[model samples]
Target: YRVHLEHYMTELLDLTVAAFDYESKTPTYLLTQFLSGIDWSVGTVNLISSIDLKSDKRITILKALTLLAGECKGELDFLENRVVDLKSQIGSNTQLHLRYDKNCDYIEKISDTSQLCTRLYCYGRDSLTIESVNEGIEYLDSAYINNYKYRKEKTIYTNIEVASDLKTYAEAYLAIYELPFLTYKVNLADLAKREIWQHEIINLGDTLRIYDDDLSLNVKVRVKKITKDYVSENIYLEFVNYLYLPKFDNIAEEVAYLSEVISNIVSYDDPTKVSVDAIDDLPTIL
Candidate 1:
């Protein structure tokens, strides 16, 4: 990012043909250039993409990351499987937590919230339309059609519903991990052959959540099992409820303590700017 940023400023701002002191294609220089425009209000780094991809340096880093991804593809694939184990661990821990036998029933709630159920629908058929929407979720088809067909940039989210504000306990739980939920990133395009309904949390969040630094809160992982057993096969069954976070004592102090515990790790490398979501972000506890 620094390298790319420097190149952008040098060329775009007309810095000159000789202001290039460092490698214009390095991440360091791109980051430097990107940080130049950032306004750190109250120690908060507030700025959008510093090194635009068009920059030679930014492109270089992109290629490098891509190359690194290729190099680590084997390990990455192994890690992907580990992600399933992690989820199972999360689910098991949740069960133990919910049991509340010195286990604290908090884990179950966290696991539920962690499962982000993403649904995809294409725009109208005429103008860069959503040729189709994979509403059922697990059932996916037509990779290219599922993805590029409806531009996340152009499409607008409809019927934004607020199903209860972010739970105070859940926020506290999240604050603890600083980065639990490894965010399991996966590529739907490469993973799929024809249609693309697969997604993680990042890209979708860009189009979905237009705010939050234009970045998604979580990363999406596409599970390979395309043909999940449909209800058409099974007759009567229990409503399996998942995709839930957690909430502990509404007490700000306790929650704050949890926040502090995680804060140490979350901002361990950073300058401690990530706001530890306090009890105030929660509803007034009666």
Candidate 2:
């Protein structure tokens, strides 16, 4: 018996120092690495940090690998032998080893690949047992043609409110399909003294509102994860809103209401609510 294993390997190439700064007199370095391999063409590291310490510290490189895995399409494994520390000030350039393989856990299962071309179709259900014309094919003969006849009535359909306008509906549909998330870094030095003492600046479950002037986009999100760099005193916040899957009864009405709310806040020029260069430098605002 002949079996083929569909597998790919991705490796982090030479590390380059992106940023070097001093925080509270502590020397800090931020390094970036380019990842390339069989499956992945080119990938850039989002954030990296390195700092000098009195004693040697073991840093787990899995976090970086894990982030890369999420961006990749299929399953991937890190090539330990290929990983090399081209340049470093903290310690020796020894080859790092990983105990377990890293793979992309985020997988969206679909019923049929061909049905992806069709906009109106129901998914997320077993196609084999259920009679579904949108399932692509029932059975293929020697000629590679489907034996079953295509019938729209036989297929399971999802009942959703159809918007009148195509453009407006498209925006509403996309918003529900692709939920938005925000990620940004926060520096401690830019924050006020009183706000600095509070540890819940980037804490999870905290609600945040982000406004983009150029795009005219306003998103209300909750902090999902917080990654803090103690040496550099920099905190990375990842926020996401679980507001997808609109109510089936009034999709257009909901979309219109949301649009109105965003419009009101952006157009409102309330002096008390809006700040014009008030440099108190609160950590929560940052």
Candidate 3:
């Protein structure tokens, strides 16, 4: 029997909001508004009631969800009958360690330094420059520059106008780029079949401890992506150190997904032959 199928969270990136403005509202309230704006009927917002947020801008539904998720340290879980539950502190501090010597199927570790930068030049609304503690048009990561014996610089533009806010934004941007991106792709389906490892199905955002004896590496990472094959019942997972740094959508990924979606489109000349449910599943072709 084939069990792996589609989930409701897959539609997040396709939804967009032209504009949204909210001030001093709880994360639950903002999440409800975002779901309503996208006409999504499956999500429940009960996490992070203590935190209040304020924002006024246009953003994608996925981006909005990521922002809120980061604020709450939460993850979205798809439940029965298309229900999505936002759960806070979903990852446990008690790490589940995975090591090659412990009978893991396959493991590939990668550290990406292509996005690292020691300095960032930022431009805000109407030539508004950051002139606070770190003055000038650029913000520098002095520690990173000193350690590397050189500087890698990049430019960024934002809609924030206030000087203090711009400095904060620039610092955050610089921090993300100052460190190398690290991830591990593992195929642990075989291990999952074992009695000791079959306690629960691993989902996104779960904390995992990965240990490599040969490399002398030990680190805890969050589940970043999951890929499953319906036919083979095989599962693949990607773990990352920085969850919010690398965006989920990129040009190559977008193009590949679009191609797959187009290939899946079933074409029929006679509309009378298609059922209402089947018609509803088809994407609108312009």
Candidate 4:
């Protein structure tokens, strides 16, 4: 006679094996499965109960896990604290004062005046005592069109003789070659491609934040020049002198020390000068 323990063994106990195997293994198999299952089940239940299962709490947990698994080798809280300390250092080290005036029309008028044709005349006597005149003139077209259909661009070439009388010219030429503006290529591949030109995206005197991956630094800059390559679909943005972001823990202190060293040479006591002394002062804790 065969007796089936269907409901008890299979349903209640959650047995995977058939009745034949269960009957053969008897108490050994049942005891092992029961112990292992209960051990894992209890541990999992305790873990879940320890953590709040709310949406915000779960998100926080996920973020912590992501940070722990990421390539950066530091505790999240420690990294945050480090960032705060660096910001404090930067605040104490650098003074950035910006002033804006409605001078666009004035600048345009000056530019137009500078591009006006200027004629120069030099007189010399010929062999037969006949008077001869030499004239040099240059100008930018007043009606120059700049649009999607027609873009006007020009290249300027200048030659300076390094004669004994032109010592300043020679020095300037050498200095130009050594300058970062002439040597550095601000080619950012990721930001090179855009739907519109740089000028359309950002106007003159606009502040920009640029990041250099190689140096792992951020620089605050202002737009100065924009070059576009229509055929290559590449845009190059040139920036004015920039301030580097505080990177090291002692960078602010170092900057302060340097400023002190040159304090005598640099002065801001003029009546017209804007006071930015409060920029570096830390807030007092209450």
Candidate closest to the true structure, highest TM-score: 3
C-alpha lDDT of all candidate models, in order: 0.24, 0.29, 0.61, 0.26
Q: What is the TM-score of each candidate against the true structure?
A: 0.17, 0.25, 0.54, 0.20
Q: Write model 3 residue lDDT over 63-136, tens digit each, in one string.
A: 87777776665666655454556665444444577777774567898988788787777777887677555644
Which 10 successive residues of model 2 have the least lDDT summed?
Answer: 97-106
Candidate 3 overall Cα lDDT vs. reference? 0.61
Worst 10-residue lDDT window for candidate 3 reads: 277-286
Positional deviation of residue 284's Cα in model 3 after best superposition, in angstroms? 34
Residue 81 in model 3: lDDT: 58
lDDT of 4 by residue, 1-286 (tens): 5342322112223323221212232222222333343211111110111111112222222232222212121111112111101011111112221111210111110111222211211111121111111112221221213222333323222221222212222222221111122112253332313444222344333444444444443444454544555554444555553122122234335344334323322226752221223211211110
Which is superior by TM-score, 1 or 4?
4
Backbone clashes in candidate 2 total: 0
* Candidate 4 TM-score versus the reference: 0.20
Residue pairs of candidate 2 with colliding backbone atoms? none
4-85 per-residue lDDT for model 2 (tens digits): 3321222223222222222222111211232322222322222233322221332223333332233221112222344322
Clashing pairs in 3: none
Q: After superposition, how far is residue 140 of candidate 2 from its true place, in Å?
A: 29
- TM-score ranking, high to low: 3, 2, 4, 1
Once fitted onto the true fold, the runs of candidate 2 whose alpha carbons sit more than 4 angstroms away are 1-118, 123-175, 178-200, 212-217, 242-286
Lowest summed lDDT over 10 consecutive residues: which window, candidate 1? 89-98
